[model samples]
Target: MTDTALSLNTIQVGANARVGDYLALLKPRVMSLVVFTGFAGLFVAPGTLHPLLAAVAVLCIAIGAGAAGAINMWYDRDIDAIMERTRRRPIPSGLIEPAEALAFGVTLSLFYVMLMGLAVNWTAAGLLALANGFYVFVYTIWLKRRTPQNIVIGGAAGAFPPMIGWAAVSGTVELESIALFLIIFMWTPPHFWALALYRAGDYAAAGVPMLPVVAGPEVTRRQIVFYSAILAPLAMTPVVLGFAGWLYAVIAGLLGLAFIALAVQVWRETGERAARRLFGFSILYLFVLFSALIAEQALAPRFAGLPGTGLGLWG
Candidate 1:
C-alpha cells in the first residue's frame, strides 16, 4: 500500500467544501457527453414516450454517470495526488474528504437508480445502477491499479449509457443497442490509449498501471491502431442492423476511415503531438457518430418510403 493509502484517515481535508467542489466531484464535463449519448439512444429507439418521461430518463442516466465519477474520484484520491493531471482534483486537492465524496456518490447513485425505475423502466434503472457499481468495484477498486488492460475492461461502464437509454424506450435490450455498446467499447481503448501515450509521465508518477506505464509506448501505439481498425468497420453495423440508414452509413464510413487514418498516424509517429490530436479527434468522432444517428432517424424516413432508396431498413 502507498503512504497516502496507509494514512488516509490522517489526511487533513479542506474545511470548506464549496459548491464548485461538489460539482467537480461529478466530472461535469464528461457528464455532458454521457447526457448527449444517452439522450440520442433513447430518442432513436423505436418507441413512443411522453417527452417529459423521456427527459426524466436522460436525467437519471446523467446523474448516475456523475455519481460514478464522484466515487471514482474518491477511491483514486491516493494516486490522484501523485499525478499532475489529477493532482488538483477535489479529493486529491483536499477540497473534499474521501468519506464525504463517497457518501455523496452513494446517495446520488441510489436516488438516481430509484428515480429511473419509477419514472421509466426497471431495466433501464438496473442498467444505470449496474454501470455505477461496475465502475467503482470492477474498474476503480480492481483493474485500475492492477492491470494495464484496465480501460479495456472498465470501458464497459461508460458504454452502458446508450444501452440503458435504449432500454428506457424499448423496455428491453436488443441487438441494435448492443451494437451501440460495442461501438463505444471498442472506441475506448484507442481514445484512452491516445491520451495515455501523451500522459505517460503522469501515469508513471502516479503508479497507475495505464498501458503506457506498463507496456512500452510502441506496444501501446500498435494497440491503438489495432482497436481503431476494428472500430472503423464496426461503426457501420447499426445501418445493417436496421436501426440506422444510409445517411448514417455514409457519415460513419467517412468518420470511421478518418479515425483509422489518425490511428495510423499515431502508430507511425514517435511523439505526443499525433497522440494528442487523436485524443481530441476521438471525442469529435464519437459525438459526430451519435449525432449522425439523430440526423438519420429524423431524415431517413423521408427517403425510405420511396422504393430502392436503400436507406431505412425497417421502412
Candidate 2:
C-alpha cells in the first residue's frame, strides 16, 4: 500500500546478508506457529487430502505468512528503527533494503498463491491471498498507527490459516473451521496486549498507538482480563459444537482456567512481570490447544472404542 517500489536505498552489506537475514525477514519463529495452526486445520477437517497436497498446502501457508511478515517489516521499517525491541530488524538495521524485502514478499506471496491454486485448491489460495492483503493493506498501512484496535482487527489475518487448511481438504469452510478461527481471534487481543503492556515505551516511542500506550496500563489490564474471560468460553465452544472431542474439552477447560488465572494476576499486579508471564503462557496455551486438536483428530481416531485410548468430540 505504501509505495515500497520506490523506497530502495542500497547499503553496504556484502557479507552481512545471508540466508538467515532473508529468513529473519520472513519472521521464522512466527511463521512456524502459523504453519502449525494451518496444518492443524487441515488435519482436523472432516475430509482428507493426499499427503503430498497436504504438505503443499501447509507450505503455501508458511510462505504466505512469511511473505506478509516481510512486507510488514518493510512497511514498518521507520517505526521499527525507532522501537528498541525492533530496532535491529533487517530493514531497520540496514541488513536488507526495504525494496528488496518488498520484492521478496510480493514474489513469495504470488508464487505461493499460484502454487496453491495449481497444486491444492483455489479456495485455500484465495484464503491465503485474503490473509496477506488484510495484514499488509488493512493492518500495516491503515490501522496500526491510526487505532488502538489494530491488533483486534489485524488479528483476523492470523486466524484464517486453519480455515484455509480446512478448505484445502474439505474444499469448503465449515463450522469446525470457524471454531478454529474464533479461538485465535479471541486469543489475539490479550496475547499482544500483554506484550504491549511491558513495551509501552517502545510503542510510544515508535509513535504506534498500542492500547497500553493510548489508554494507559490500567485500562489495558482490564481489557486483557475482559478478553481472556470471553476467550475461555469461546475456546470451549468447539467441544460443545461437536467438532473437537472430550479430551479437547478437558484441556481447553484447564487451559482456559489457567489463562484466566494469569489474566487475574495481570489485572491485580501492576508491573511488567505479570504481563510477561501472561504473554509467555498465552503462546504455550494456543500451541497446546491446537496441538491437542491435531492429536484428537489424527491419532486418537485409530484407538477409538478402546478404553482410555481416545479423546475428542467425535471418534
Candidate 3:
C-alpha cells in the first residue's frame, strides 16, 4: 500500500511538471470580476432561473474567462517578461511553458462552451465562447502589440460577462442587457488608464503601447478625467432610465462624485503617488457602485409598493 501511494504521488508530481503550471496562467483575480458581473446580470434580469442552472451558467462563464486569461498569458509571454507588472506571470516566469498554457486554455474553452450549451441554453453558451475567443484571438493576438487603442477595443471582452449573464436568464439580448454592457464598457477605460498612468514605465519597458506610455502621463491624466466625466452621467443613467432604485441612485451619485474627484486629483497632481491613489480609488468606486446595485435589488422586495421606494427614478 505504501509503495502504491508513493508511485501515485510520483506520477502526480511529474504531471505537475507538465500541466499544473498552466493552471496558474489563468488570471484568477480578473476571472472573479467576470463571475461577479455575470452573476449581477443574472440576478437583475427580470426573470426566474433555476438555482442549479444559474450556478452552472456562472460556473461556465468563470471557466471560460479563466481560459481566456490563460491564453492571454500564453500569447503575451514575450512582452510580459519585460513588464514589471507581468514579469512573474506563469509563462514569463518559467513556471509554465507557453504551449502548455495555450493547450490548457483551448481545452478549457471548448469544455466550458460545450458544457454551457448542454447545461444552459446554446445562445448564452455561444456568447460565452465567443467572448473567450475574442479576448484571445482579437485582443491578445491582434490588438495588444499592434495598437495603443488596445485597451479601448479590448474592453469589450471584459464587458461581456453581464451580457452573458443576461442571456443566460433571458436566453436573448435586449436593450437592458446592452445598457449593462455599455456601463461596464465605458467604466473600463478610466479604470485601466489610471493604472496605466502610474505604470507607464512598465508598459514602456514591455513594448505594450499603452496610452500612457505613448501619449505621456499628463495626456493620460486628462484622458482619465475626460472618461470619468463621461462615466459619471452614464452611471446615473440607470436611475434616470427607471432601472434602479433611489438607493442605487444615491449610491451611484455619491460614488460618481468621489470617482470624479479622484480623477480630478489625478489630473492635477504630477506625481506617481497620485496616480496610484486614483488607481486604488477607481477600484473602490467600481466595487461600491456595483454593490449599490446589488443592495438596492436585495431591498426591493421589502420596499415594494412603498411610495418613496420607487421614487425619483430607477425604482
Candidate 3, which ten residues in sequence have the lowest lDDT sum?
A: 304-313
- Per-model TM against the reference: 0.92, 0.91, 0.89
**Residue-by-residue lDDT tens digits, candidate 2, 174-224:** 787888999999999999999999999999999999999999999999999
RMSD of 3: 4.8
lDDT of 1 by residue, 187-306 (tens): 999999999999999998888889988988999999999999999999988878777778888999999999999999999999899999999999999999999987767676555321
* Candidate 3 CA-lDDT value: 0.80
Looking at model 1, report the run of 10 residues with the lowest lDDT sum.
305-314
Q: Considering lDDT, which of the candidate structures 1 and 3 is the better prediction for this target?
A: 1
* Root-mean-square deviation per candidate: 6.5, 5.9, 4.8
* Model 2, TM vs. native: 0.91
Clashes of 1: 0
Q: What clash count goes with each model?
A: 0, 4, 1
Shift in Å, residue 266, candidate 3: 0.6
- Badly placed stretches (over 4 Å) of model 3 are 1-20, 301-315
Better of 1 and 3 by TM-score: 1
